[model samples]
Target: MNLLEAEKFPFQQTRFTRTSDIQTIIKLFSQFSKEELMKKNQEVSIAGRMTGKRMFFADLTDQSETIQLKFSSENKKFAELDNGDIIGVVRGIVCRTDTQEKKNERKLSVEVEEFSLLSKCLRPIPSSYYGLSDTEERFRNRPLDFIVNKQKKEIFFLRHQVIKNIRQFLEEKKFIEIETPILVSEASGAQAKPFITHHNKLHRDFYLRIATEIPLKKLLVGGFEKIYEIGRIFRNEGIDARHNPEFTTIEVYQAYENAEYMMNLTEELFHYLAEKVFEKEKFTFNSHNISLQKPFRRLSMIEAIKEHINIDFAKINGLEEACQLAQKFNLKLEKFQKTVGHVILAFFEKFVEKNLIQPTFIYDYPVEVSPLAKSKPENEEIADRFELYIGGLEFANGYSELNDPTEQKKRFEEQSKQKELGNEEIASFDKEFLEALEYGMPPAGGLGIGIDRLIMLLTGQNSIKEVIAFPQLKNKEKNFE
Candidate 1:
């Protein structure tokens, strides 16, 4: 039947006075003896969707638990009810049944006195006996997937708990949650191409934020000592098992702290999440076990490259020498990737990143790649930046934020030069951000963590899409035929 016809059907809309959930009822049944149950004979009511049916017996399930319902063959209303139908049973008595083949096994059931069909299932649901096997179909029809697989539903619940724990952890540390704009004239945050849109009323173009870094740091300059924003960031980038074009991030900034402080904070937060949320100090992701115990391994970017590739970047002096070494390794370089720092970063990405299976912090990044990070005091080429890698994925990026206006302007100029050299990922100089820095900002540290990746790691999910409820997918063109 059509939807309108189904709506017109005389389905009961009365409220059910359910005494307990299926689990609670089962617990109570186990507590009371069979003779005591019969003596008390307390009437119960419950409502849920019909999940299974076999002749006169049916299984009804709320999202939490499932209970059995037995119907008399003579009841016409019971005959009309089918699997996948919304049902409400009233004045039911708890009972136990034993099969002749399995006399030792007793099953709990509810003998129904009256029942109502709240909604009709006109279409047949996919067989729960067989399961939803197609991955694409499962993603497309997520609600049906949830119905068929309880584990899938629980993953989302776990995701919610993880986020809640993160919020609580940050709040306990006295970090203020703040919001920043999603659209702006310049997307000067991270090194990624932005999704641009025209603002009709203003008659100008605005880019969706690729990162929350710039604005949050500006708030730091505005005298908010500890601030954080958990928001969605958009980037026009390639999609992979780990990367999404649009994803959620938690960016935090604290004044009077350096990269070391952020690192320690990150370690503490992860340990807290593992203990409080998962109730463990370690968890396995994609067959690789990871520990959240204190003191994650720390390695400088150059040191990691040296360990993995056996090429000491510290000894390499000039751009020509770096390019020759990269060429010898057969690493591909873009047009703008000619500098020594760029080559070092390329080597790290190609040789070092995937091998970092344990929780490790690779710090001291090239200054050219980290425009907003402060340079190391002794060495001008390396920035006080670090990236947290676990399960062969980069989960977090943080740095000692650069507050020097003169040096910041010079760095922006260098980024502009790179943009002119055909690097689309290089951010344009944000005048407003520079002006804010000119107003005398404090020494600070900033960190950005990809929420989706973290969730995937903690939940043991292999892909970012698995953690995200509605991830971006390619458009399916309809076939007229």
Candidate 2:
């Protein structure tokens, strides 16, 4: 059984003051500036962890603010106090004072007047210097990690700002923010394996959605011109620093717009977010600073590959020849590789992906990899798809949707063949979605942004775990069980 099921219990009410209501405490402390209290008078009372505790005095850092507590057994009020006790009360003015050992220590000292313990700590929290080194434990008990590490908290805060700014940008552009189902019968949005569970009442199995693309597209087919959904998607895959079993993605679609328009829109959105949310007009990654200003660099897929790898993918007409070339360049390729586009992708990823530290749009992917996108007019082998990369990370993928019912069916059939041929990530065809497209989905553009990856980039966090609040972790063995 999963941890979620094992921990299932009847929902109960909470009694303590919720975390947010501490604003009253903030207001009370606002009477004295943190600096003024340190200089003129040294007094304050607050509820916080004893981050740094000592014999005579200790620093209490709370969610609202930080203040120190000076204790004496004769003082009666603090006779029963300890470092980790969650206390509440009134104290003298908060002051900054130095100790005999360290002269430069800045502290908010409080002379305890009244006190009460809201909660008591039995087990000591691990020391921050050697705290929660194991990755699984850290993710499982994430709230404690946030309490111990300040940088982790800041990264998530920046993530919220990124999402907020994106919402504002889309709303400003008249894009309606909508929601889609997480459980579905057909997961035709993207190429990924899904987690499936039995629907007891329905007597059927439903898979978790891998992407919001299909449902959002259904809305577009239903006559809504512009819409977007920022939601959770689940994929059954191996975990790594860059991948999680469950993550967030934002999908947007606009009626009558091509992939080119979406490319421009994505760049504008990212630039606006960097300037507004991050408060930094330029991004520095891997020693290269990329300015998120208007008119970002854009290049055709073939052109980018050619510039970096010195290879002409246009001339590599067959998969067999492409595989030979990849082998010469030490790229990952199987002898049974069937698509020239797949070979181009493998070659670019091996040789050129790391060089794209700045914001760059690589356009015109192989049609084999983009089942729902329109094919290029001049070269039917290529699809009108583009992916935006920043700091060597693929942030967004968009394409001009294949609206013609016949072409859409043919692509789905190809995808079905791939699925049958042991390609576990190939999408399972959704007949209803295809039927909706048959009703004539207008020529439109669709985009899916990896929200977690975007947040990681904006927050300057190299690992996806840093940006996610409670990333999925392996089930821990419970001794009680």
Candidate 3:
């Protein structure tokens, strides 16, 4: 049959009920299962690819269903029907069944009487017993993976469920979902490198957004009290099991809400998704079980570091001393440590982060590392920021957004100094974003959740690739030793 013709094939309008045309239905397949014929002597039409064929005592037996299809073909024409052919139009008596002759296994057999070829297969399918195993090939050709692997298909389906549930929950909360510019003049908002593209006609450089935080905040300034975006973000960074150059993130901004409220929202979102998606009220990470019954753990940055390693970062002498302590903890130290705050963050990441197995909010990070978060009321040196981590993976980050243009300008200047000192990832000041801040954005709570990482955690996938349809890989031509 022509491929296009097969696509346009109309229904035959044939219906085979149990008590009608029993002989005609039984003869459809080469073989039938005992249970196949045990259906109360009913006439049924079953169609599928022809798989196995055999001949016993001059009787052509086709193993289509559980029972052996014993039929008389003078030249053994049924055996010539190649594997994968869609052939079935059988009439058989439905009888209560068992395979007594075949002692190895028990199967119901259908007594096929007459058969017809609905469609013939010119080629055979891949062995169902041994499936496509090459990981890269499977991803590159995902349709084949879906055809052969039920588990692989289910993974993506679960991913879809996770995203859909999240969207529905946010929508029910009356947050207006918005789409912001993926291509922007300046890559402000988060401290990450962006992919630069040029507009030939405009002769200007545009960048893929590193985070939706800034644009959503801009909308907040524009009088939209609650806004959110589930967008694709690009970061020019190293690819790892946890990090991808191109990833998905959900950013939300709620005006008049503080970092504390954002933290609660984050926790509730996770718990809601977990219960609805995984159908579980508890999650186990690294053999440590956590009950998702209600509220999660809340730990300050200092408190976390203090609990993990008895160090009071608040009491540290200065930058030099903090640097020395960071060095002692085996954290990477670059050229200069202008702020002790950087060292404090580096230490917590190295010593304390890997131990936070259950859901915990590590908050009040040093201001130097959190340029976009508002400073704490009692302490100018600490910013009101919180990061949620579970399964030793950082899932979400939230904060009371810094809306003071003057303070933001100072932060940008500090970041510019670091850039001058050669930190490539420090973001450039977007004049437009600053102008938006000057227009007076509300004291809003903003969130950035790594959708890929969250999917990985929820799906029990350890690597980013398991969740991502495609992940970044190093160019084979690039030389690195």
RMSD of each: 3.0, 6.1, 7.0
User: Which stretches in model 1 have alpha-carbon errors above 4 Å?
Assistant: 1-19, 23-36, 40-42, 99-102, 478-481
For 1-481, candidate 1 gives per-residue lDDT tens digits of 3434443353546565677788788877866655677787868888888888887888888867888887888876676667788877867998765544586765678888987667787767776777788877777788788777777778888988988999999999899999999998898889999999999899999999999999888898889999999999999988777888999999989999999999988988999999999999788886799887888999999899989978998899899899898889898888789899999999999889989988999999999999999999999988999999998889999999999999999999999999998999998799999899999899999999999999988888897878877777655575332
Off by over 4 Å in 2: 1-46, 76-79, 90-92, 95-106, 128-136, 284-294, 330-336, 474-481
**CA lDDT scores, all candidates in order:** 0.86, 0.76, 0.74
Compose the digit string of candidate 2's lDDT tens values, residues 1-481.
1222322211221233322323354454546655766566533445556655566576566654455566655754344445455555444444444567677665435655555555555556666556667766777788778666766777767787789888999999999988989998987788888999999999999999999998888898899999999999999997777889999999999998999999988988887887888778776654567777777788888899999878888777687788788779877654324678888888778777788887889998989888899998898899999999888878899999888888888988988887777788888878898889888788899998999988777666667877788886655664322
Pick the lDDT winner: 1
Error of 1 at 253 (Å): 1.4
What is the Cα-based TM-score of model 3? 0.78
Report the candidate with higher lDDT, 1 versus 2. 1
Clashes per model (N, Cα, C within 3 A): 0, 8, 40
Candidate 1 lowest-lDDT run of ten? 1-10
Model 2's number of clashes is: 8
What is candidate 2's local distance difference test score?
Answer: 0.76
In candidate 1 the C-alpha lDDT for residue 362 amounts to 95
